[model samples]
Target: MASTIRVRATSSGETTEVQVLIQHPMDSGFVKDAKGETIPPHFIRELTFEYDGKNVFIADWGAAVSKDPYVKFSFKGGKKGDDLKISWIDNKGETDTTTAKIQ
Candidate 1:
């Protein structure tokens, strides 16, 4: 199956810029479904990005975050052709991970 995480990492000699997009429902439990039942809380609890065996970025999120969240940040050191690992875990214990090559 295809990963729910999409990431792009670009290195510019001294820094690496990272962008991520995650596909999720992010239900806050306050909204009702078509049947008027609560949707329940379902959102990403944490997101991690690793490079060279170390974490470069981490995000702690909650239901206040919108569906299909997008994030962008820059790190101190990275090189082209290296791999960046991205992963996330939702409130329901579901997880998805992906590796992106620096460009």
Candidate 2:
């Protein structure tokens, strides 16, 4: 499966807020194919966010989540031009990561 992640951050004086959008097909094995074959469970298992090498947020997800999930959150200790990193791992043992800097 293909995934896409977008990150945006805003600064207000000494504080910063970040927003993230993630796209993925959170498939559950309960569904059956046209031929009545059981589909394998495939979903994101973990997600992590960091700012300037400091861990900020982490989440553990399950198959109950919907496809193309989008999450928005904010934290302190962020400044303009600081690097923000986001990463995720899927049940299939695949991993993906992306980084963006506050502007």
Candidate 3:
């Protein structure tokens, strides 16, 4: 499946607030499909947020997490023009990444 990410960043004085929405099925492998077969687990294992090539925030997730997870965080020293990158790796070894400029 193709995953999509949306990121928004806004600065307040010296701090920048960041929020993101990641698209994924986040299946726990316990749910049965319409055909009565278990849907194998497919969830994001790790998510990282980087600012200016430096890690600012990271999350370790599992099947328990909800689909299309939303994460919000903040960091210092980020301005409007700084580069923000977000990426995720799922349990199925699938990965996707996206970048945005802080607004």
Task: Give the local distance difference test score of model 1.
Answer: 0.94
Supply every candidate's count of residue pairs whose N, Cα or C atoms clash at under 3 angstroms. Answer: 0, 0, 0
RMSD for each model, in Å, please? 0.7, 2.2, 1.6
Pairs that clash in candidate 2: none
Rank by lDDT (best first): 1, 3, 2
Task: Give the top-scoring candidate (lDDT).
Answer: 1
TM-score of each: 0.97, 0.86, 0.93
The local distance difference test score of each candidate is: 0.94, 0.83, 0.89
What's the lDDT for residue 55 in model 2?
83
lDDT of 2 by residue, 1-103 (tens): 4437788877775777778777877888899999999889999999899887788889899998888777777887688887888999999997888888887
Q: Pick the candidate with the highest TM-score.
A: 1
- Candidate 3 C-alpha lDDT tens digits along 7-96: 899988699999999878999999999999999899999999998889999999978889889989899979887788889998889899
Candidate 1 residue spans exceeding 4 A from truth: none
lDDT of 2: 0.83
